[model samples]
Target: MANGVERELVLLFSEEELREMSGVKRGGEYIEVTCGCTSHRYGDAVGRLRVFINGELEITCECTPGCDEDTMTPAAFEKHSGRETARKWKNNVWVIVNGEKVPLSKTVLLKYYNQASKNGNGSHRSNNGRVCHRDEFVRCNKCNKERRFRLRTKEECRIHHDALAVANWKCADMPFDK
Candidate 1:
């Protein structure tokens, strides 16, 4: 039973992964746990796992770029990815699915996940950039006229909104130059 538990720990967290997550110095004496009662070397083959698995050491997520050293229990660590998986993205970290970036409007769903994760949240912007949906009348500064713009959904709104944003005009009737 002890060996099986040890195997699970090794499978879940490699020594390197634990080191990165713990934010301990490379060649220091055995690092101390949060409780300050137990300590183990980051590279220890068996003792490292014992420190973590036995709950003698608390696993804090120090790997993410802006993480605040949030404590991640062994179970939480197992449920999430480690530092190595973070750099796999060529560009910014995105909520990709099946090798495709999810759309901007769908970002609300990702926000929900971020709240649940209680740790490093995914990028707030989409690859497409900011997409604003306006469903009201606005006075155009250039033409000095009121224009109505209504965008009900994300899919139907991005292109139109992006184009109007670049042109810096409200609607066709309220053209910028005119």
Candidate 2:
């Protein structure tokens, strides 16, 4: 009877279960486990099979059984998830930052807007009242120094433009050049 009970227990866990049990569990609040070709489990699951950290589900799996457990806070989950899947384009546009897709928030859009407004009209217009034909001739509005302001359309000196824009927007008014 004892021998039969042991044999039954061995048969209960299928081959797949045996493989999963053998695989490594990389422990972390947010861990990514890959079972290589030997295992056919890869899919994100939240709760239950997935474990959480700080009161929120942080560890997402690409495995089949789905995730179980809750351990991270909502804030931590968002932060971790965002970083895991951030992708960038050749054009320097971050298609995804962290796991969240780009353009989902105002961060990228605001960056684009500020880049477009960098040179102000002054740099575009030459002394003759003609638009500067050379990209390098445009003077940064903030620094009053000439640079290849091709990347940004605003008049800010490359170093100060982003900071100025952020300050201006935060204050609900254009920042005074100090």
Candidate 3:
């Protein structure tokens, strides 16, 4: 089973701020691109980002209406790092969420998503390659505070349910999921 990871993208401007700066009127609705390819909308809490994870510099138009013409042009955002293997356009950017800046890099993202195991803990991830979200209770070793969250169970197989297995839980940030 593959473990899941979460990576964040930090934007320079908030989605709302970007809408204002880009001359997009807000009506709590999706805005149509100049070419009318497709309408774009941001969620109430989170905004989506279209980013390239490969080294290729392929740019496409978000314009709907079936226009084949490319819309946005790629600009040199940063220099290539020594560890980065991308030969062309730097596919790295930042996103802002809740007034916090999060760096989005292809290399960094790839490093995170490519791993099948946790950095230290081997059992925190579910068989579905995601952080366990099943309800569980665990006492922290440091603060000794019992934190309950939704994570997966050890005997979670394809068959019967185990109501008695409720107490079998993982720790909160323990060296291992004991």
Could you say which candidate leads in lDDT?
Answer: 1
lDDT scores in order: 0.36, 0.32, 0.31
Cα lDDT tens digits, model 2, 24-117, are 2323332122211111132222221222222222323232444342444223333323333323211212123334323212222122123224
Residue range 105-160, candidate 1, lDDT tens digits? 34221221222233223223334765344355556667767665555565435544
Candidate 3 residue-wise lDDT, 66-165, digit = tens? 5444434222222211213222323333334334443344223223232333223534565675655335445545575776443454444211133224
- Model 1 regions lying over 4 Å from their true place: 1-134, 173-178
Clash totals for all candidate models: 0, 42, 15
Which structure is stronger by TM-score: 1 or 3? 3
What is the clash count of model 1? 0
Per-model TM against the reference: 0.18, 0.15, 0.21
The residue ranges of model 2 lying beyond 4 angstroms of the native Cα positions read 1-92, 95-98, 103-108, 125-178
- How far in Å is the alpha carbon of 21 misplaced in model 1? 43
Score residue 120 of candidate 1 by CA lDDT. 27
- Which residue runs does candidate 3 get wrong by more than 4 Å? 1-20, 30-137, 140-151, 154-178
Prediction 1 TM-score vs. true: 0.18
RMSD of each: 17.3, 20.8, 15.6
Worst 10 residues of 2 by lDDT: 31-40
